[model samples]
Target: MGGAGNPDGPTLGGDDVRILLVDDEIDLADVVSLHLEQRRESFSVTTAIGGNDALSTFESTEIDCVVSDYEMPGMDGLALLRELHQRDQSVPFILYTGRGSEEIASEAISAGVTDYLQKRATSDQYAVLANRIENAVARHRSERARQETELRYQNLVEASPHAIFVHRGPNILYANDSVVDLLDIDDRTEIYGTDPLSYVHPDDRDRIDRRMRKAFDERETADWAGWRLRRDDGEIRHVESRGAPVSYDGQPAVQVVLRDVTDQRRREQRLEALNDATRELLTAETPEAVAQVAVEVVESVFDEPFVAIWSYRPETDQLTTLAVTEAATERAAAERNEPRPVDTVGGDLEMDVFAAGEPRVIEGYADHDDAMTEAFETVFMLPLDEHGLLSVASVEPRTFSAAERDLLGILARSVVAAFDRLAA
Candidate 1:
């Protein structure tokens, strides 16, 4: 080295760090190496005569950071930065240049330089470079870890089975695979940045909106169960969901996870309807009054157009209508006041249930009888033991599930018990 560094200057000593110093000036490079060597316990510095030499050194040796002169022969610092990025973008590169300018700084930044420092004649310049190198490397490591974490979260959300959505206020930012399937959507692009509340059922929108906003404001999680949602195809569904305040894409937002629970909710409502009917059945004074209340309770939980109760007299072997729903009364021309013997009526599901004293379920009733005047698509008949049978009819095909079958069976037993009590 041509000149010696000041011994009085602050020592650049701390944790051991590997640094690659690049400069074309052999004398300057030697001088800088000498200065760094004085603090050899803290820093292990290697010198490169130019950018090409720096690249070779980078490939062969492990380097925590690169400090290079912007103006150099053969390859410059900016070119060296590009080469280092192609090999490994994580290593920090600093442009310590004598020809410092706004244009150079901008160009170096665009080339992905970590830090820019102007060359000074003072011996303390090396100390400054040492500090800058430590900071730049620390920052780069931290950012890399953050990016890795975010990538992992993204992958998890994409593969989730439940409908997962992230929203800021009313606008939806992201949605998962299940959301597309639940909404019956072909493309996900249509969902981004749209108001999430627009997809909610008319009756449930306000409640969900309030919950989401409250969760965001409180910075806590909010859970909502048995919420109705209208799909893109205009069919209603139920969902249980939870929302929490989270940082998404560096912005304050709420992340929501929705689980489709339409089947579960329907089962719950059917149970509730059965309980309601049981309460009404216990208080009923007459069998006719019991039939009317049962029809009302069952009809409240189902989207059926018609419901009726028929009393079965074993002595006469006849089926007589005790009560009919309002819709049933409106649809039929005359009151079915004329009692018909079980053998006289056609051999349909209704007659079969009465004869066997077992429940009967029919799907697509029109298929069974094309000439059928009844507009209903599905029908169910549950025998009320020795008293009568309950009939439920829906305009939608295959509307009742297995859970409904079990629930309806329980309700039928309750009605029978109530009838036996009143008779005794």
Candidate 2:
């Protein structure tokens, strides 16, 4: 038999404490194990005849605490304590024996024994041992739980995509990898212990400071707001940030999460500009006016200013250049003197997309056509529903993103509506 089992079965709700009871006398070990189990429903005691047997049981089982006799054959309580600590230094070990003295207590204390209890004839001594076991086990479990929680938090902070930084008052305490990348810095230590507001744009510093102060004073979460961050290279980046009160190094601090929103904010502004252009398109009196508005809108919305619009005359079957941005005119100055015919077999990508009634993105346009200039690398050819074709070219080879294509579609439809209104 292993030892005395709890008469009421294993303790419910994971409160079971597996205690290893070791003694040279098998009968005394069994009696002590039975008393511990009988005293607490959560205690399930296992007996070992000697130190070697206790070590074997400890290695095989998940023991929370070890209670061993001071005097035993082969290995005494102190030796067993050393052996058990070698395996798990944190596991609680108690020295319980009848031969107890001040010298033995001091030696056990020096040996890192959790508790030393003197054995007595009265059964009341078991109650004292049971209390010490529970107290030591409780402390051990709590420490393990705390360590696990810290490990999980550390992993989560490092893996987060958003730039996270903790600061107490004006001093930055910690920054994650994303923060280092966002600031365009090679090392995170460069910003640690530095004032976080030093990176904020001068125009946004006062406003952000007020929000941070309110969050820290009230210990409340600060709402998300847009702020301009000046990177180490002196480039301004737009970000949306929110702050929540947290404890860092046992002191109150604020954890701020910054999401890079520079691209998103630019897209929103471009959409707003397009909306304004749509109003202008509706007021145009002719197809040429519509083409003029379309070219202007494309030039303003895209980073590439090389945009042009051509009006298709079905009767003459000719493509007439109605409008072109200043950048496009400068880039195609030589071609402006001699325009290519739409009926040509080659080097007429714009006419091909217009006739096909579909939009096309052509990369390396310079390579595709002998007539095309090397100044333009990529071109977006979009049809304006038989009214005309619109072309936007860039010096860099790039395909328009889906959102960019959607904006172009909106502009094209608005131009078509203007043409229909003029025809009516």
Candidate 3:
């Protein structure tokens, strides 16, 4: 048997291994415990005279492995094995006995013993027992670490807010809760094993496919790219996503995280269109020209059909409509029998916003008792400094988001700058 003197003997180094040695023969147990400790400097051995003392010691101390004799006074090694397993099923237990036979070895295996060794007169037997103890302890620690790592990964994936999915080849392997909600699906099972590219817009599929291929084939991370996602109901949503090569269930796959950017993209497009309109506003030489640019910008960028601009007249204490969109004209055509008054402005809402030089958004404008409110449900009144007021109204109820309001403010300032240039 390979002992401490053998160069290739089993050796373990790191944290100390706590071992509980149990035998009715006190001298035999002490000698075996001493030999094990001398063979491996990392081993710390504790001795117990019988099964009852072994149980008491096990409960008090954190023992990594147990090396016990077969026969004892009240509780035998097999009886102690059952009690120890009830507390911790994974702890390593080895049966080292003098009366070893096929009957005892078979019985120890049935009781879930980690290892079995027959006692011998030779002193070298302790070295072999030490090697078995080291192997069992190493395996136990590795398995525990793996279970902890998997538990943490599961918790992180479930708590993430962004849509995450793993795909191998063309089939989806895993998808989180956010993915189901993003696709507008009632169940996640519907997405599993299905092609991920089927949900992508027709125009964007080829580009997304290329990016995913690069990620998997090159084993590199794909940079974020914007794409249109077509939902189950045929609604289109704008999303940005990044992908990286990952190992899923022992196979190479790609894990992608998708973030919804529909609202952000729409705001960016509106700002770009507004910037173009600002260039047009700079060319206007008169207030009426400035109002035309404002009307067109509001109609096109905001998708609001009913838009009107009013010029303030201090001498008459009134606001007269200087420019209106085609939709606005069509809306008022049914009520306009005679030439409207030059001072005929909108209701008190417009007058208040103009007088205060502040913007106001009125939802349910159709409920107001005003001539212009008859056909519109929402109205956004923005004052162009002291020059005039710009109003964009919708037929359906609408509430402008804070970002939309900021964009509208930028439009108002552009018009004010144009008016200042005209005055100069």
Candidate 4:
């Protein structure tokens, strides 16, 4: 037994539990504070003479628990409990009083009291109250820590830009907001409890499933680069994805993080293709030989059936076909003797582009010449300085994206350089 001035109590640890002791009677409050202070190793007690004073102390200080007398001149323990609940329900409150009644106990319970103790002089009464206070405070701290940890994890997941998913076996348990955007989904509920592999491209689904299973079974990690993921819109995008075994809902699950790498992969492939095409064009001895090499490389790299290179005749002011894909060789040969006007191509904007020395992309092929009729719905044309024109066509509409146009422009530049060397 020790008072605030006594040193007979246990030594306090670095992290001491702070407590607020409230009672209208100054003597009773002092006695309770002394008992708590005796456990100086665990508790640091702050005394409040009344409920109002207790409220003020609670606000200004960081208190772990509130121990209050039932009846006071200003506010009873029940009223104090109501006020405390309104402010924060997380702080543990215990009602310690000499008053006794089952109705009073029931009322305290209904008001959300953390613990109730009947005041007595049995010598061990304070010991029992002290135990109750310690237990309640410990539980509250533990729960608050857990909630804060969970909140932090949730915030991190929400803020991440990469798509993330949690899955058990094959069933998806959760998908973050970024996953919704990546998959073009309206609601997360649409993916919950569904197989995550369902969205993977059919060609890659089996491989991804195998990797996922191996990671889960062995509790290892797996990763994939340049894999295809088919979105809800049926468009396939390249992604670099990783998977690791994680705990979800108290069970072993797989956490997947996927990042779209379509543009990056395309750029890499385009660079490689351009290098190959430039190497081929560099070996040509004549402009016609350069056209043959350029058209062949473009066709092989793009996998398109329609590719042609025209040689500009300065005297005739015409662009005549020099090289054409075999599938369109007959059609191109028929127009070889004829000169297509440099100003316009099938009433399209290629005329302005030819004059401006820029690339022209016919996304819909709506204004192409008669020679291209029923041949292609999309066309990408770039002038090779005053040497000739390099054009690639696809039967599918809208096949010429910005990326494709840029890649072709690069190829045109290389071709123009080769033509200049030949003319030299």
- Cα RMSD of all models vs. native, in order, equals 6.8, 6.1, 5.7, 6.9
- In model 3, the runs with Cα more than 4 Å from the true position are 1-13, 20-32, 47-58, 66-128, 147-199, 213-218, 231-233, 245-259, 280-293, 304-307, 320-344, 362-378, 393-399, 417-424
> Candidate 3 lDDT (Cα, whole model)?
0.86
Which candidate model has the greater lDDT, 1 or 4? 4
| Tens-digit per-residue lDDT, 122-155, candidate 2 | 9688777888888888878877876787577668
User: Candidate order by TM-score, highest to lowest?
Assistant: 2, 3, 1, 4
Candidate 1 error regions (>4 Å): 1-64, 83-91, 155-245, 250-274, 283-288, 308-361, 364-377, 386-388, 394-396
Q: Which ranges in model 2 have alpha carbons more than 4 Å from their true place? A: 1-14, 23-35, 68-90, 95-125, 146-219, 229-237, 241-263, 282-293, 329-346, 369-371, 418-424
* Model 1 RMSD, rounded to 1 decimal: 6.8
Q: Residue-wise lDDT of candidate 1 within 1-424, one digit each (tens)?
A: 1023423333333445688999999899888777766734456789988988888999999888898998887788898888899999789998999997999999988888889999899978877776677677667666776778768877998888888989998788888888898889997777998998998888888888888889887888886655888888899888888998987776788988899988877788888878877888999999988888877777677655587788876776766778778776554433334332222222345656778888877778746753133556777888887787788877667666778788777877888888998999
Q: Who is ahead in TM-score, 2 or 4?
A: 2
Q: Please state the error at residue 287 of candidate 4 in Å.
A: 8.3
lDDT of 3 by residue, 1-424 (tens): 2245434255445677899999999999889988987777788999999998999999999999999999888989989999899888999999998888899999999999999999999967887898888889887776776667646765787799999998987999888899988998988889899888998999999999999899989989999999999998999999999999987655789989999999899999999999999999999888899999899888888887888998888887777888988777666554354334322465667777899988988888768765354667788899988888998877778798899789989999999999999988
The worst-scoring run of ten residues by lDDT in candidate 2 lies at 1-10
